[model samples]
Target: MKLQKVLSALVTVLMVALLVVATSASTSAQEPKQNDGEDQTNLDTQLYLIVATNQSVADEKLPAALDSVVKQLRATLPFKNYRLAATLLNRVKNEGRLDLSWIGAPIISAQSEVSPLTPSFSSFKIRVVKLAKNTAGETVVQMAGFNFGARFPIQTMSVASANAVPVINYENTGLQTDISIREGEPVIVGTLNVGPSGDAIILVVSAKRTSR
Candidate 1:
């Protein structure tokens, strides 16, 4: 009976020691799970995005555009809030722009000048199309002649796929267009006809410039 009692005491002590050790380990892990210093370091490392919008686009549109720009930023990077600005086209040309600029001291200067919707943005333009009309109210197009006449540029431009007609028309057309491809290559645009309404598409085509 004495031997059995001693053995029972040893077993109880071993179980108590094991519980204490496990509790200590768990407390240690929980204590360091959220360190203020480490959290501050993470915040310091977060990135930023700068958005630029045209003066013509309404202020209400800014919110929707901002949401889209934010979604794009999230898809490309890991961040939340982004900077917003309303800038002119001329200013964008002179200044650089971006929707998401990594926060770092080295690229700060260049990031300040970048406009998110400038010619330098990737996926800007691979194809170009425009439509116009004369005084007679005849439908004008850059490439086509009829229902299919309005879809010529997409059919011919190298940027467009073989069967990708009209898909790249961009619907609207104007008088003169200056489309800038990658490497600052300017593709001059001209319109051949307008629609039957005779309302000539009088517009100055320029490289699309927006901060978003």
Candidate 2:
């Protein structure tokens, strides 16, 4: 009888050991999966910036206006990428997922303080003129901006007769032989046929200087 009782106790202990081992194995398997899930969640939480601008401006006006600012951040900051979206002010305010943004004037003034980053611009200029203003009264064929760093000019041409010119005005020559104006470092020359309004131009220069 004593031997039988001993055998029963041994059996119980073995069963308990087996149960403990099974539970430990299950826990170990579940832990790795749970850890992986958490790692993925962290990756999803990684920050990305969303840049938004107003749609009221013609689409053509936007790329140049904002690209300089975006490029600054891309050069300096640590972010995956920036995405441009045209969204209403209220919609932007309500989104919990917006990590960073480059918004228009209205949104910038309103929500910039609360955002993770503040938007700023690089020195740039925009000139618009009628195509008839060029020397020799020829139709303005292209607009040029001189980037001093590159020591070359960025020239763009428009078809609707109205040329949008952005010049990097290093020389400060005003409305010379070429129908162009000075930005900061590069001079912008305008071309094309739309200059009848006598060359209405807008120049936007920023306070920040890019490092060499």
Candidate 3:
């Protein structure tokens, strides 16, 4: 009976020691577990879709935050105007996958009074996402199999024929590539030429930790 009690006490002490070690490891901020459970870290990402067009327009100021991006675009791309298309936010755990499908909403045509425009489809997907700190002390988000695709209506031609309507065709375009973005900094993923027109779509993305 005495031997059994000694063994039990020793086991209890070992278990306590192990638990203390675990507690210390978890609470050590220097050894961060960014890929841990949702309760431990924030893995939400925000993406901005901007349309770059050759068509000039008034009030063409993009968000001041994207000023650097715009300057770079102007130096490289031939687009004369930029417009904000959409802003999307999605949450993903580390090394997890996410896909979001878009349902295009129908809107009445400004040119044609007879029918509403056809609905288009758009989607974004990522096969795997990871988060880590870079050598520059910035949190970096790395995404693999990043894909953005869409189909939209485009007017083929305008005619003055009596009792005739303009021809519209659906065009499919997208961009697929891997991307790495630093926290709070917008990174341009890629661009897709929208249609026969000189317009293009630019995809900008950023990520942040909502640990607060």
C-alpha lDDT of all candidate models, in order: 0.30, 0.30, 0.76
Clashes of 1: 19
- Over the stretch 1-212, how does candidate 1's per-residue lDDT look in tens digits? 99999999999999999999999999898885765653111000101124222222222333342354445544654333233322212212212221221222211113443433221211112122223444676533232111111211111133457865332222322222233222211222332233222212111112332333
Candidate with best lDDT: 3
Comparing 1 and 3 by TM-score, which wins? 3
For candidate 2, write residues 45-150 as lDDT tens digits: 1111133223223222334444665566446544433333232121111112222223222111223223323223222221221112355563332223322110
Tens-place lDDT digits, model 3, residues 131-196: 877788877888889998887777788777886777878778888898788877888889877666
Error of 1 at 90 (Å): 22
- TM per candidate comes to 0.22, 0.21, 0.70
Off by over 4 Å in 2: 31-59, 63-212
Scored by lDDT, model 2 comes in at 0.30
TM-score of 2: 0.21
Model 2 RMSD in Å is 21.6
Q: What is the C-alpha RMSD of each candidate to the true structure, in Å?
A: 22.8, 21.6, 8.6
